[model samples]
Target chain A: MQLPSKLIQDAVEEMAKLPGIGKKTALRLVLHLLNSDKEQTTMLSNALVQMRENVKYCKKCHNVSDEEICNICSSNNRDKSTICVVESIKDVLAIENTAHYRGEYHVLGGIISPLEGIGPSDLSIDLLIERVSQHDSEVKEVILALSPTMEGDTTAFYISKKLKSCDIKLSTIARGVPIGGEIEYTDEVTLGRSIMTRTLFS
Target chain B: MQLPSKLIQDAVEEMAKLPGIGKKTALRLVLHLLNSDKEQTTMLSNALVQMRENVKYCKKCHNVSDEEICNICSSNNRDKSTICVVESIKDVLAIENTAHYRGEYHVLGGIISPLEGIGPSDLSIDLLIERVSQHDSEVKEVILALSPTMEGDTTAFYISKKLKSCDIKLSTIARGVPIGGEIEYTDEVTLGRSIMTRTLFS
Candidate 1:
């Protein structure tokens, strides 16, 4: 193989670092960049650099934000009394995109996985609980929007135990074979979560 | 739907600008960056910017370079009288990595693609022709290292016609089913190229 310029190879290597992007895919991206106009490449480069520099976590919700508090947490139109607890900021955005959810979010940074050395103390569970308790009007609901993974379930269970003493309604995102999908391919974690989160369908 | 922060969405949009990457994949990449260590993300960002700013084309061969002439063109060990003609800079690198071809390279920039409105005029054909005529001790060989596509064939034919009067041995890379591949699963293009570039056992 001929050695590519160090700069071009560096760009490909950087792109390949992204999840699911292999070397071939990264090469395609680099080629695209090379073919594109200089103005566009500069825009992409500037955006990448600015993304990390300009964006920050909201202090109140731990969601990605450009301000001290995320827009979701600070907006008066949202249901502040009902905060959904999720494993990461991406989950918050996913739930929000559904448009059916009107409540704010609380990001836990990550789920609990004892095998991976991540525990309750490592996450933002304490902060979530503290937020619920400090609310003046008494929070109504705490919805768990963690993934269907083992760590997500473990974190949910641990959080549930701590919030059990509170009077708030605790629930989780629905679980089942995905919409219009076969059950055979469903992983053990999803199947287990589906069973655990099953509702009484009258 | 809760709107993703402008900064976060902007990053995703920039990622989606890459060829073959859609919005979902871009979002996944952005989330991965969001989860990665600060230093890693910084390095990737810096590398992307550096790639655009630091790289330039080699004046001698029209291959990608960080200096006036590429390493291959400047090296005294290489066969300066032999020029490998390729469709792109990537091809030059691909040939270089084999470490077998000890010669200079000429990047045609792209093959003749009438469907895409690309022609000989769109490529660096003129420069390549000029190089051959101007150089002393007429080049011994010009290896065609283009993809085995219709456009590549047309471009190669055009170049050969232009250099018919010159004293040079013209050759092309081999085409066939890959070493480990079964004929049953061979792609049409490779199979077709193999037929077109067939050689007799005699």
Candidate 2:
């Protein structure tokens, strides 16, 4: 075990804690940081600090934002009556990047995975219910954009049960063989979308 | 034309500046940082700052160090009289990991890569000559540990010329088939080592 300097080791340890980053990758990254210009390294350091300091979840929609309300929630052009519910902030970003959806968003933080000890109460489901109930006059459609997983299915079912008596229309994104996709190896998104868009089963 | 936030973009730009990291990889790294824990992200940020703050080149041997002299230069057990000159700090780490060398090190910062607009003057050749010519009675040998590249060869030749009149035995690491290496695709290290260790250069 060749012992690098304490600073290098600390940088490596912190990098290794990131998703998919191992010790070797961490060392490479740290070495890269060392070789970079002083200003560039400082910028990287400050950017990391600033990212955490600036970003916060919007009080209303729970989407990531640098202010009290997220851009989507605050935009007057967006459809306030349609709230797209996603599993996390990344999902919200993915949806926004498409530029096809002009609706507000709700991030559940995570899906309801009982096996992983994540129950319905662990997510922001209650807050979402409160938002819907309080803004009953404005909300007309609730789009479940959760991940295409068993946990996603369970959470959607739970939320749908809670909103059964409400006048709002419950829907999900279309599932089918995606564009430029191979039908043989189609993922859960394609499969789920295909099934959801299937002709009336009755 | 995906316009990420300025904070995210800054992180990506900084990551892209690293060796072997492309824009896509930089984006991936930024996303990883975004997903990382706040405390761990802060740790990484501070580590980058600390890495820049702590390490500096040793005044005596030019090896990277936190003090005026590097660990090898300060250590009493190492053979200080035999100075092994290399290209960079990474070379020092590589040689140290081998655990076969017990001599001191001198980092030239880089070799004489004329193709890359680097010449003897670009390296620490003058400083190395000064160190060698110093009135230190303990000096016995100078080992060239440069890579077996054209630039490395040119740099070694330049150094050897400068040290020609010095009362010290000059040698280089061997060139030959490496241990556990096949002759078909033997790298420069093994080939160079084999040649250096050869009885005659037929």
Candidate 3:
């Protein structure tokens, strides 16, 4: 489609580059930016650029950070001895939303996906192992909170093997029926796991 | 959720303000931008800023343009005598994509929606009437190509009443079975319209 101007076309193309946004949606977004306050576009543009230019990663856990260490890793109140391992800052946010875990985190960046040619070397697995294996370590347990996909399991297995020599214990989130899921609608594998792993009514 | 960085949090908030994006999708898009080449983010940011700062509107039709008058309005190749009235630039684009209409366009920006408190005075309806009314009249037809909704019908009725003083013909797009639509699945209203407006089978 012929846009009214080159600037519009360029903006639409750029907007369409984002995942899940089609050309029509991109055009709608661009047109919205055009009709909205100039300051809004400026704020969005500046925020994106600022993030791309200045956003740093936590030195210890590889989480996105303004400084070398993220707020989660540096907080004294969090359980430093129990680290939750997962992929990406998004996962960190999701886990934090649950408010169940008070442990420090180990962000692996991404799991071991051979299909995408992403191996152990591509991620921050070494940093996590080193963080757990330090002498006179306070790190006692490493919980693998990665997704239960094949790649996630593979990544957890590789990291656990490397941390075996260390004093840290390895664990994972249990696979069972979701907390609010109805038993009738639950899949067999999950329902069966929930039943098998059921603790005596306590 | 506590984001790892202020930059990320700000960007996510700004991105989430878009029509369909939520916080989670905003984070995903922002993270994707981070992992991609800085050039992509820079280009997107620059395009948005440039478009917002410099985008112009066609003087005659009020469509988005890079110059005073849009190409369609000024072009000698298009039928200047026939003006297609539309609700927004998106409508203009949809019609333009068909390559079916060679007429000029008069963008109303939005329809007369009482619920949204948008009246005829809020649009470019006055400008459209003025264009059709100058002495030494060149205009022959005014096509109401607005959507076939309640608001669209109201706006069309209003414009047709105003254009009654002019010697130009007023028309609307045909509403019937969409191309490639199955007869069994077609709605009753559209099927009835198709029958009522039946033409020569040639």
Candidate 4:
């Protein structure tokens, strides 16, 4: 859509570049910013720029952090012996929100997706191996907490193979019907897997 | 949700302040930026800042512009004898996209809404009146193309009362069931209005 001002157009175009936002939504957002206080726009712009320029990644797990190591990895309360490997930083946050897991996380940054031209080398898998292989490493188990997608399974298999020689145990998050999900509505593959991996009743 | 870094949290918070965006969506967008090139985030930030700092509004109509006089107002091809009044700059773009309206526009910036504490004085009603009342004014018709909401009708009525003494003709855009809209499914108010204002077939 043609905007009245070039500046507004540029801002809309930039906002549209983000995932899920289209030109129309971008236009609306830009118009909203135009109508709001200049300070609001300035604050948003400064925050984004600061995030890009100053944001750091955990040296070991590649999770977004303000320091060399992420808070989880650096915390004394977190169990460094059990690392939960996931696809992205968002996954790390999702797991953290549960409050059920106290283990440190290894953010893969992404999973192996040949369709997207993302290979194993493109992720932080090598860092995970190095972290688990350190001579003085305290790691005893590496849990694959990735998604249930084919890409997630492939990444899990690849990591398991790479750590086969290590003394640490390798496992994955359970795949099953969600707690509130209706059994009839569950997909065939998930239902079948859940049945096959049924746990013993206490 | 607890974020891993304060910078990420700040960016997410600012983004969430925008209309229609929530914390989860904001985090997703911020993470997408973080995973992509640093230059991409820099460009988006720069564009927003530039738009906020450099954007200007048309002196005549209050539409967004880079110059004091907007392109539509300055264009000789446009009809100076007719002015389409709208609630916002977006409305102007919407009308311009139709390519049917050849007249100039007068953006009111907002409608009179007491609940929102917006009044006629907060808009560009005075400028519009002054423009049409100029000694050598060429304006002959003023079209109220505002929405059909109660606020829109109230604003239109207010404008009509204000321009009652002027020689210019005041009209509103036709309201009816939209073209291609199914008669059976159309809302009662719209259907009623369409029937009441039905025109004779030529």
lDDT of 3 by residue, B37-135 (tens): 999999999999999998898999999989999888878899878999999999999999999999899999999999999999999999999999989
lDDT tens digits, residue span B1-202, model 2:
2422556666667767777678777776766777667777788889878987787778888876677777778889998788899998778888998989998887898888877898888788888888888896477899999987788888899999999989999999876676777877987766776777678648
Q: TM-score of the candidate numbered 2?
A: 0.85
**Top TM-score: which candidate number?**
4
lDDT of 4 by residue, B1-202 (tens): 8888999999999999999999999988998998789999989999998999998889998888999999999999999999999999889988989999999999999999999999999999999999999999999999999999999999999999999989999989999989999999999999999999999999
The superposed Cα distance between candidate 1 and the true structure at residue A37, in angstroms, equals: 2.0
TM-score of each: 0.87, 0.85, 0.91, 0.98
Candidate 3 lDDT (Cα, 0 to 1) = 0.91
Distance from true location, Cα of A198 in model 2, Å: 4.5
Query: Candidate 4 residues A68-100, lDDT tens each?
Result: 998888899988899999998878888888899
**Chain B TM-score (model 3 vs. true structure):** 0.95
Error of 1 at A130 (Å): 1.9
DockQ of every candidate = 0.58, 0.51, 0.81, 0.86
Worst 10 residues of 4 chain A by lDDT: A89-98
What lDDT does candidate 2 reach at residue B68? Answer: 79
Off by over 4 Å in 2: A1-4, A115-117, A184-202, B1-6, B20-37, B184-202
Query: Which candidate number maximizes DockQ?
Result: 4
Candidate 3: TM-score of chain A is: 0.95
Q: What is the CAPRI rating of model 4's predicted complex?
A: high
Q: Per-residue CA lDDT of candidate 1, range B101-184, in tens?
A: 988899988899999999899888888888887757557888888886788889989999998888788888788998899888
Give model 4's clash tally. Answer: 0
